[model samples]
Target: MSNYDELHRFLLNAANVRGELVRLEESLQPIVHSVEYPVQIQRLLSEMAAATTLLTAILKFKGEIGLQIQSKGPVNYAVINATHDYTMRGVARWDESLSVLPESFQELLDSAVLVITITPQEGERYQGVVALDKPTLAECLEEYFTQSEQLATKVTLMTDMSEPTRARAAGMLLQVLPSQAANTDVKNDTQFDHVCKLTETLTEEEMFSLPVNDILYRLYHQEEVEVYPSHPVSFACSCSKQRSADALRNVDKEELLQIIEEDGAIKMNCQYCHSEYVFDSVDVEAIHNGQFIETRKDQ
Candidate 1:
């Protein structure tokens, strides 16, 4: 069966290495088309969504993971947020005045910094930042793992934006298990490098079209892989009329009433999913009165 919108995890029992493969199809469409982003921005946002899924699978705790890139360049901000179950949503913003956008990652995000934030459901949140000095998103992620976790990691992020209406993205992650790496030997290190070399042979066609198992076999045909149950991934935005109302609670009631009086209603929009929520006088009054007033969600 096809592994579209699913994540598969595997471990090389003999080499003490772990791997994850994720492919996004239907889950990527809503995100890519959430706004009228340029081709470059679409590709970049897709890549980030794939990477966030791969990273979320590597975590042992149940929480949310956010991968963000910020810079003083053409693209000022981009972020992909994912939950432990692989539910994902993302958005990107770029300068519209520029006639041409850079085709390379470094050029598009000059002086950029990649930030990885993990917020556990029960524990304190953790965040790590690294300079986006590499030419590609994959390499910069590898640098992050090396610096923050002290482990050698390899990441491959690919996107198929050929069909404007049907975009796809996929990613693969390889890393050494910390528990099994207490006593690293030269032989084991060599084996890890060997496996990484094989992984480098993956092409865009195979990565985007082939099944997860098939791709793994093609790359690690000689290694003993212990595959785990696959997890389903989908596009889920954490936005709703109630959440929008909660945000409006912070604003002064008089100010909100003034806006409602002028416009007949207050409107809120979510950038991640292009969702619109409108609150009329009654809804606003109920909100201020600490009463529940259910309103329909606008798309």
Candidate 2:
């Protein structure tokens, strides 16, 4: 079984490939606390949440990476946002049925698409979209990386919410070093193909519950591996009243005042944390008077 309560990192010393494993049952529980979501929806979010943490750890840049799914089915949408530090938060919208768990994401989500977005701390954002034409989120994400980033990235996400209110979600990612030159001849393709075949043999159970060492050894025992120190992940939300105020500062005075008058106070909700920020008439006037000067510059 995988190690509990920690993230594990491993690498192939001979190859330009690396992998990571994490157990996030406790880390993700708080995210689903405020709502009574269906089991299927909760499981889905757990998988996505786990995967987002994995993606966040892979990034060598500063900023946030978000994963989103939109379907024409009962569960209208789900999204998980994560920063490089493994800070994450998620929320979902469903029209009905907490028992909407289908055997497959395709069946559960009607014609869904997985979208990946990256927002650098100081640069423009970039997004990549992939069709959820697979049976699992892991496959859908793998498709995105194969097509969008052109990198040989394999991802697996899993969760166990059976009892004891336990929720364990973890993932393993394998990708080739993009900087390495690929042999144009058929030989390189043959070796890459071999690795892919080995990785394909991984299972959801093994990934979710197996120890990181066993998981890696099971897949690549024949190859040399270099393991690294890992950073832990949790269900962290980056929301606050100050951030809510920053967003409000962009609204025109008329629009701001109209909202305030209509509701007696301007209410802003943090979609990530579900925290409510109420702005009274005074708060509204201060916003208009350039009290949040930095926000004005943003506008």
Candidate 3:
């Protein structure tokens, strides 16, 4: 089987262009298998995961990036989050019993809005929003780059579910670098168009099965490319008992006590990791007294 859970970056030696390729397997299985998602939802989640990974690689700061889709159609919402370390998690809410799977973005979502958020560890957070008017996620993302970043960008995403046990996703991104006075003779548009056209030749099978170097060679054999070391990607959730306890403290005291009295305890579930934090009367009392301690249970 082809190696997964890896991200590779490369630069076109002759053109002012850079690119990234990412393949996901183990990192994606837990997210897709966390709940019983239909094949269509599963595939969209995989693509979102791959797109998140690609976007995370391009960040210049230490932060977390998130891609979220909100709609009024069969698919209500979908989101994927990735940190600078490449840890990723995602989920989608949808109508499960739909008779037919959507064949296009417009079919799957109504009045859809795509939101991209970036929060740095210290600096201010940033957000960009765009309409999901395009047919594919790749085209929508490409529009974001053009409208928000003013850069010529191309994105290709693919997911393979042929294997029963493992679902795989892979994507590639190419962006034109800013022009420099020293290279005024190089036509940025021509270079970007050429590289983008070559990248368009990649097939789903090649994206999922070929190694990064092999794929680059196959696509740009006539050009000089400088490949970089691969970055490891994995599925990791940042949820913890302490975080859950802190969140619980924000609830009204009377409501907390009522829940404790009615159900014996107040349970908080982390949607990202599916971890549960149970707070009994004692814990609630401590929290009310500003002496709360972290307690956890895996569900």
Candidate 4:
């Protein structure tokens, strides 16, 4: 299987429709292996990772986008973040005691809500919430696009969690572009439906193993697609010791002292990367005095 991670953009010359294809391997391995999650949860996280990557690629600004699931069932919380540069990280929380995995999204996440957040570098942050009424994450996301953007969108997500050591995810997005003429609405809808039907024939094996061009050709050989250069995707955490120290400044001094007294140092762990940062007594004092403080990684 190809382990390279990349995102590709394509345009349907015949129709006013655009598409994106994302394949994640190296970028998803670290995030999925950060914790010992159940196989089902791992699959969900992997799908979210691919979905976030696809969504971020369509952004017009420099910022971050996140997909968060808040539920009251076995799976409590799940989140995936992707930056404009394609750096990705994700985590999930679930009930460890549950022995049987839920068979459906509704069973796994009762009373769940999916939240999509977009933070632009220069404008106000935007968010949209959608009920998890669909059977799959991709369908739920399609609902989000229809309700929020008023654009017809189709999303397909596939994740291979069959092996504990090897993780792979891929997703494709197809959406109808905004039209200027009322007469073209019917024509655009017909084009979108025809292309979507072809996309629906894609399989998990092809999505995981096939190259972008091959996949596109196989699905849309009859149609003309204008393929563009691919963008590399990677797993990168935006966490650093300096950022950790800055976060410590917001903590109460007394609480910091108590933590130091109990453990001999204050430890802050980055949930995204699983990197630990430790601050000793002197370091805490520097933070209190409004001076720069340095921290050492926990070996």
Predicted structure with the largest TM-score when compared to the true one: 1
Error of 1 at 203 (Å): 1.4
Q: Write the per-residue lDDT of candidate 4 for residues 54-135, one digit (tens) a residue.
A: 9998799999999999999999999999999999899999988888888667788989999999999899999989899889
Residue lDDT tens for model 2, 158-260? 6777753666676767776676424322135555556667877988777776667787789988988788876766677777666777788777878888887
Give model 3's clash tally: 0
- lDDT scores of the candidates, listed in order: 0.88, 0.74, 0.86, 0.86
Work out the TM-score per prediction: 0.95, 0.84, 0.94, 0.94
Give the worst 10-residue stretch by lDDT in candidate 4: 179-188
- What TM-score would candidate 2 get against the native? 0.84
* Candidate 3 C-alpha lDDT tens digits along 122-163: 999999998999899998998888777777788999989897
Error of 1 at 237 (Å): 0.6
> Who wins the lDDT comparison?
1
> Which of candidates 1 and 3 is the stronger one according to lDDT?
1
Stretches off by above 4 angstroms in model 4 are 180-188, 293-299
lDDT of 1: 0.88
For candidate 4, the lDDT comes to 0.86
